[model samples]
Target: MHESLSFLAATYVGQPIWLWLAFLAFIGLLLWIDLGVVNNKDGVVSAKKSAGMWASFSAIAVAFGAYVYFVYEPDPLYYMSPDNLNQQAVLQYFTGYLLETALAFDNIFVIGMIFTFFAVPREYQHRVLFWGIMGAIVFRAIFISLGAAIVNEFTWVLFIFAAFLIYTGWKMIFGGDHEMDLNKNPVLKFLRKRMNITDTIENHNFFVKKPDPKGSGRLVLFATPLFLALVMVEVVDVIFAVDSVPAIFAVTKDPFIVYTSNIFAILGLRSMYFMLAEAVARFKYLKYGLSMVLVLIGVKIIWNFGLYKGWKDMTGEALVPYLEPQWSLIATLGLIGGSMAYSWIKTRGEQNPA
Candidate 1:
């Protein structure tokens, strides 16, 4: 296992810096076209157009993934190995991206709840999501940094995080829980009681009008409802990140790959949220599927640690377990794809019975 990790790390570390730069540049160009050119319209993205954007965004990600595989870590030396540098990079990228995107579906559910609670206007929904993503970027950066520091300083931390993942996954799969009860939400209730709130949403404003210092005009900053909802968004994201960050760490300790995969998936989340909100209700079985993934990965992490120590003591040899990474990658992909397929089929079958 150590040798395999060393080889994998070597391939990544030896990749040329220029290749990474080109990849970033391409993503930037795509962002430019998306915000500057395509999103010039004022209203919500229609379903047909949303479908197109999804296709385009996915294509860009896949193309960029291919570019990274070939340019950075092109396999050489007869190129016939079942395992090669390009294949490894692609697998890692897909695994990371899939985890981020799959978990993002949960985010859409919360966003829906937030918007409904605050009564935000349909036209301004994108703005909230845009700013929410910005906040997520900052929050995830802090989380990744803290997580890396802890994992490095204490080797046993992985076991604790793994146990938590397994527990959360099990609860999600078997607990049959949904619909967060407001009475149980202490923070939200506390904020509502403490803050002054307006009865009606004024011109899609988030807060009640307040007097400006200079007496220029009424200021419309974070209103009580908006503030409460944003808080919910941040809190929800933190919970989701707990499962996702550790899963990514299992893939590769390289911060660059982890951070980049997170960035690409998050960049598309605003559009994805709008696209998936109505459809999320149909995916009754998805939570179970995601739970299965979390348990599998958590077991893999614990097993990896145990396997390494077991081999070292028994044979006086450092061995990293074989196919652990590949199994994780394959299982993560299967859970996501299979869940979505099942959800789609169930929804369609119910709509038009056989």
Candidate 2:
């Protein structure tokens, strides 16, 4: 019993094993409630319900941030006495979570576009988003794990990550308007070429078995457009992770914090999409705001260069960047908030003509 307890208490990826297990288990419970209780039926989630769901999930993330503040051990090794969570730990977690959620605003736009391109109905969209996000949760886990490992081993990679984010941000801010042509998506093409897909979604199912036209006595599993949409969503997730993973790492190298923050932020996207799907593009300037957010996070990483050890863990060291976690959080809120408000006001003016 003691050995078992000790095993759970052992550290993994800069956090105790039990903490990881607890967080993951809690997430599993949330998903079960979503799948089994809250969203058991195939129906369009109302805007009111979607907003409520987003609020609930955001509340949970905030509460968990508090939990992290109270329980997270700065030194997982317990080298120092009472290494309970400090302001910096909580700040980093909040900053990462907020950054990820901000980035997802742009992602929701693409996802909304994907669903539109596939001509998916409101009812069937739920299943696609649920499963696609499930896949995202898994893939992002791998990406975060690999990322944390790489950054921990080679800190110089922070510079590389910063450079990539800044370059991408610049492109986003200056890049001419680009539209997604789903027909040109390589993943979609590959899936289409390989799978015998139906012209339309079938009873909200991703696949349906049909008798092949080849005069065989066997049924072949045919993928539906539903499945194709799910694939596109999954593909989009991988593309976005390249930015979000590094953006989070710019704040902290702890895999546990990164994983938890990223997942929680993603949990809100399904609801956000439901609430804003048909209207996300109306907020024209929001994209620029999110792009600037990426730039802010990137610039935060590059602040003070290597002179202050900016990206290092703040647990025991005083070498944290000059732009501290609190400042990052504040600036992040400002950029996201200001851009959104500005976009809202401008969009309303165009609609109202004064």
Candidate 3:
């Protein structure tokens, strides 16, 4: 099955450092221009503006998608048959993008809650989300690298990932603890034990350094709650990554497509958070839909494993073969889009009362 899928794992993992650096710089430039130039407005980012930004980024992705399509298909680079060009590449990009975006929807929901928890002003929310997404990019890069390494070395790691997805799905569907207990976090505890934390948040600043006792120095430190919130966000990101990264692997093993799409999806997340924050609460059923997707994908992964191991009889296999990587990608994207659309329509109907 792996051979048949035309896995481009080596091509992606061996992506040049220069290429990676250039990609990072481009994304960073866009982010700076977005926050500094286009969205210099003082008030909340309105729906119209947010929608426009979403469209712009999506258009960029599609243009890149066309380049990828033309480069690989018909034109043919390193492959023999034009059809030999892996469909997994395109599907993987789309699947990884969809999974990352859906996972980010949960992140946005939590960010909204966090903003409410702190009573942060609307104008500052974008700044916070910007920093949060920046942190997420770093953390997720670390996560995807570690995860890809493990999954590459030990195929059984997929089983562990599948189990994790099932457990996470169960929790999401059952509505697990949504409480944000700062005290329970180890980083917060350590900070409380070692340092003095101000009772009030001062102008939403996360860090404040004191003058050094030795005369010519400074001691830098984060505000206690800021540290706590940062820790909380990191924890949430790790949880989401565990489910999302594996979900994409079920689509394709092409790390370039997976990682690139993941980056693009996350790069847009701060803007998405601003746009979705208020409306998220109304889409109560969306979590259930995502949970179901997680469960279904997890089951698919397990079933594929069984098929690979030849656990099923020939007749059983003949009846229903394992899901293909391309089909899996398409299905995952379709499910997420359909679920969001359904939730939006339902929410709209409720608002209209007709």
Candidate 4:
């Protein structure tokens, strides 16, 4: 037992194992307080209540950033200088958090659609989202670990990520049809064929025992619409992560920064969805902002690579200087903020012309 505990305390990936354990404990506590304490009785979440929860979660995330700023010690080899490491780590965390949160707005829209297609009740929606977020946490951790390993081993993989981001962004900007039909979803189709699924929800239960339809006396476990909705939600996140994980990596390669920022953004997703579901349509221009963000980050990645390689033989000395994290953070915030501002103003003007 002593040796096992000692091994668990040892450092991995630049931070002590205890730090990772602490983070996991913190997340587990938040989940408990959310599902078991504050929302012990499941019901419809009012927008007002959701707004308050969103603010509280955002505050916690910001406070966590402060903790990282003050407590984290960046390795001297990876950082530019020890004097600025704390500030840089904090900035990267917030930047990544903001980017992931902004990108997740799209997820909210998709989730809302999924629930609508399934005719999921407002009261039951939160339960699905709660479990969906739990699945997302696990999926994102896997993706982040795999991505970090790939980037660390083959620096050229960053270029591929950059290219993919650019391609996805360009499609978002130019693509006209984003509508999805849940009935046509491959996962749903496959599950329907393989499993005993019921057309109606059975309270909030995902699975329930029911009489088999084939004239058999034995009861069979059947999946409810709620379960299918949960599965769809999980699959939707996986699709979004392909774009978002790369975008965060473009900000910083540190696993701690990457993982914490992604989790923090996702932790508040349920509240965010409740707060914005009805009004998300007003932010029509936000997609343009998101697309631009991806394009800019893609460009930044390529530019950073060029700086290291002397700009493809254009000069003996390196050209296209590498962008500092501070500048990247500023750029990211400006683009997202400006886009949102434009969206709000445009929508408001249309709603009430002066």
Which sections of candidate 4 miss by over 4 Å? 76-83, 308-317, 349-354
What digit string (tens of lDDT, one per residue) describes model 4 on residues 1-354? Answer: 888689677876667788889898999999989999888876999999999989999999999998988888765544534568888888888989999999988898899999999999999998999899999999998999898888878878888989998998899889864678888889999999999999899999999999989989899999999999999999999999999999998888788899999999998899999998888877788888888889888988888775645474676666656577787788879988999888888888475322
Clashing residue pairs, candidate 3?
A: none
What digit string (tens of lDDT, one per residue) describes model 1 on residues 107-163? 787788878977766776765665566678778878876776676677678788788
Q: Model 2: what TM-score?
A: 0.91
The superposed Cα distance between candidate 2 and the true structure at residue 277, in angstroms, equals: 1.7
Compare the candidates by lDDT and give the number of the best one: 4
The CA-based lDDT of model 1 is what? 0.69
C-alpha root-mean-square deviation, candidate 1? 7.2
Candidate 4, residue 224: how far the Cα is off, in Å? 0.2
Best by TM-score: 4
Question: Model-by-model lDDT, in order?
Answer: 0.69, 0.82, 0.67, 0.87
Q: Indicate whether candidate 2 or candidate 3 has the larger lDDT.
A: 2
Better of 2 and 4 by lDDT: 4
Off by over 4 Å in 3: 1-12, 40-43, 72-83, 175-177, 209-231, 308-322, 349-354
Which pairs of residues have clashing backbones in candidate 2? Answer: none
Q: Identify the runs in model 2 with alpha carbons over 4 angstroms from their true place.
A: 1-6, 76-85, 310-321, 349-354
**lDDT score at residue 346, model 2, on the 0-100 scale:** 77
- Tens digits of lDDT, candidate 2, 1-354: 887588897877777788888888999899889878999999999999999999999999999988878876665421112233466778878988988987887888788888889899989898898998789889998998899778877878989998988888899889867878889888888888887899877888888999896779799999998888888899889988988998888877768788889999999999988887766756778767778777877787677445454434444454643655778788778888888888777777464322
Question: Residue 247's C-alpha lDDT in candidate 3?
Answer: 74
